[model samples]
Target: MTAAKTETFTSLAASVLDIEARSVSDLKRYLDANFTRACECLLACKGRVIVLGMGKSGHIGGKIAATLASTGTPAFFVHPGEASHGDLGMITSDDVVLAISNSGETGEVLSIAPLIKRRGAHLISMTGNPQSTLAELADVHICIAVEQEACPLGLAPTSSTTATLAMGDALAVALLHARGFTADDFAMSHPGGSLGRRLLLHIHDVMHKGERMPLVNADASLSDALLEMSRKGLGMTGIVDAQQRLVGVFTDGDLRRILDQRIDVHQAQIDRVMTRNPITISADVLAAEGLKLMEDRKINGLFAVDDAQKPVGALNMHDLLKAGVM
Candidate 1:
């Protein structure tokens, strides 16, 4: 009986997923002139895009607003019920209103449709019914109709919500492209996010600078370089000439190689055994770029230098990990 129950559960789960997948995929057919018009409306919006919805659609609207805001479209979600209160004052003539309702008749959303138009704000509605009152009243109607709800009872909003969210993503991404939004622009909005760390965090930010960088004169003995490496706990050290300009790099990997060759760490000068013209990056280069340089060269550490090739900083794989740039 347990085995039978497992199969039944698996089959039901598969059916639900199938319904939701089709609900999203079928939206492509509905992305016609209305979708392009909606994009135009948002692209031309000078002030901000204000989103409205109620109930489950309200949750989806909030996510859409966040996505749009982060992706370069200045937007915020306003609960339709709140709009009827003093919140209506927030909308201006230059703004664009994006109303989401699976039923096309969420009373709270519909209640403010007329005022939204009266304020000279462009009204765009997303609804499951093309003939819904909200749809007729909108300057642009985006149909979010689905073949059926994933819910077996055909009552709860399941597949329809998924389709609505997907459509919202499509609209947001479309506008993001239209605006020529860049990774740097996105990072500016999400400074705390991982992508922001990748795009905004520079080598200098993650590198050990000044006294913290493990560095030694080129004439220093391998033992002296090793001591510096150990002191800094960076697994590597920079070898600099009398000019204090970077000449080479010595790493833990080189130390292992020297051990195999039986090179005397106490007797050998760093210049003779170190890796000359090692991979280097500029202080302003993105830490993500530094990571790629290390990964592509199959190395674990690097030095950040100025235009004059003087070592200004040093870092390794572990530093990148800690900086959240990985």
Candidate 2:
């Protein structure tokens, strides 16, 4: 890149960062009675939060809606222009409308203000101009004013948009805390992602169960145990008693240790080299918990035992990796 081009980009980036920093810092003073009022209004809302905005504000509103939804506040974004064209039907008296417009004078958003109010829905507005018409009509107004735009032209919404998004995040988090939203609740809303898999997946869902679990009798020969482990492809075999109770575990790691001792694998009974009373898990435990156990104990695999202490399942580190719980 040319030096001139690099300078221009660097200056613009610095301006944007400085403006946003000031915008967020200025928000502390606004967290007064008005912010409390807005939170209380939202807390009293019986239904969903209906977010609406236009232009740059609308883009921020979409993200705000997603944050609110994932944080335990049921919310969805509606384009104000579309709301006037038929989407307003989605709003009900039980819902609360959160409208965003820096000028507080977006034509599309103003167009539905009366319709929303007529439906007896609560109206909340986030704007740079509290005196503007949209704020005047709103039941609650949040100020997101900035000292100046990052744009040298002082026209584009750089700092103002960032401030608005930050305010929306603040509101969502306040409501989340008020509702006591938990990580598990967030996981439920995001099950398709790795986080959800880690938080929600249980050992029973991914562990090899029933006869598929690699297992051998305590009296089994080393060759027999090896065949069981090979067939199950779990790299380990459980040694069980006559009543199918887990007695020990034989793994590839154990094989190496035994080899170092110059033991004859061909003639040895698997029980002699197996780890007795190995660490095990219950079928109902979360996969994430299983991973933690393995990491903390410095082990690579676990057996899932039933109420009577009989081996019912088996799982390993690879299982967690495959299930996206690692």
Candidate 3:
């Protein structure tokens, strides 16, 4: 594109970002008694937080529901239009209804507001107009008002939607903290994701064990350790003592350095050439912790040890990579 066109596009994007950011910042002023009451309503809710909205509001409500559900609160989105059909049965009196409407006059959302109330559910409204009918009927109203839309025509739901989403995030995070939600708790809700893998997967779950483990006696010749490393294909071998306790570790890096010193691989003792007092991890520790230890110590392999310092398992960086722990 031409320089003038490029400049115009960049300026427009920057303006949109600035407007949306300011709208989110302005939402802080609206976090009054109503926001606190809304939080209490949700926290005390024995049932799910039924989020209701239409169109653009519905999209944001769905994300808000997901965030609330994953963080600590139990929540789900019920389309207002569908609620009028048969989905209204999903809501219970013990639940809290979080209704979203940028104009606070959305026909679909307003149509079901009375039914939600009749069910004895607590109604929390999020809107730009606190005086709007839906807001007026709500037990608590959170104002997500924006000065103007990012749209040049000021008709689209740009800045308003951004503000609404930020407010929803604030509510979820506050609830998360109140409930003492932890990373492990979050990981349980996201077991299929990388974060879950990092938090939930243990060293024994990914490390080489049984015949897959490369190990040799500390008094064994370097050639014997090399044979074990070669057979296991881990580029390393754990050198153990008479009681099968880990004494040292021999790796490809050691081989390179030893070769430069003209050490006889066949005649040299494994313990003499191996790295003594190598870093180790327990089998119960998280694989992510193992990765951290490896990175911090500048090593590629780790031996999983038991209380007696016996090598129970072994793994290299490639093992972690294959296990998706990297």
Candidate 4:
């Protein structure tokens, strides 16, 4: 492209960004008692929150529905065109219908609004014009008005769509907080994602248990503990009392510290050179918590203990890395 054309394109892009940013900021004016009522309505909904829209608004509504679903609200999106044909059956008396239209006069959306009300479902309209037909028909109206479109022709739905999406996010997040939604709750809806792995995976899910655990009797020699660590390849070995309860942990770092002291590895008891009363996490705790514990302690390995303080499993940083928990 010519230099002149490139400069023109860059200037247009900057102007679009500035306009969209202001449009989103301008949405602050729309959050009133109605917004709270909308959130409270969704919170009290015994059925799903059904979102409806046409064209570009439909695309944005789908994303809004997905966000709400992932964040603890039960929601889904149905196209207005589809709703007119038969998809209106998806809504119920206990449900709440959220309709989106930039101009508030989308024919398809209007065609289904009365049927939705007749079905006993509450209606919430999101639009750029509050006085329009669809807005006036709603039990609650959220305005997503923008001063102007980013499209130079002023015919496209740029700034308006951005404001609508931001308003949707505001609603979802408000409901999320009101419902006491947590990371674990969010993770449940997204089990295939990385956040799910971090929030849902427990130490027992990745630790080496049973015969794979590296453990030695408290009376065992340091050399014996080293052999167990080498065999198990965990870089550490847990020391247990005669009752099979964990008493201490001997790691490669301890070996390094003791090497200069000239301690007799052959005759030294495992518990003598081990870290006494080491930090321990229960097997049922989240792997992410275990990772945080290890990082805070600056340690490379950990032992998962049962109620009796006996080592049930063992793991190191490498195992966490392999399990995608790091």
Q: Give the distance in Å from residue 181's predicted Cα in candidate 1 to where it truly belongs.
A: 1.0
Evaluate candidate 2 by giving its C-alpha RMSD to the native, one decimal.
1.5
Which regions in candidate 4 have their CA more than 4 angstroms from the true location?
1-10, 257-268
Per-residue error for 216 in candidate 1, Å, reads: 1.6
Q: Backbone clashes in each candidate structure, one number apiece?
A: 0, 0, 0, 0
User: How do the residues 208-235 of candidate 2 rate in per-residue lDDT, one tens digit apiece?
Assistant: 9888999999999998898898899898
Give the per-residue lDDT digits (tens) of candidate 1, residues 133-185. 99999999999999999999999999999999999999999998989999899
In order of appearance, the predictions have TM-scores of 0.95, 0.95, 0.98, 0.91
Question: How well is each residue in 111-197 modelled by candidate 4, as lDDT tens digits?
Answer: 989999999999999998999999999999988889999999999889988888899999999999999999889989988877899
lDDT of each: 0.94, 0.92, 0.93, 0.92
Clashing pairs in 2: none
Off by over 4 Å in 1: none
Best by TM-score: 3
Candidate 2 structure, TM-score to reference: 0.95
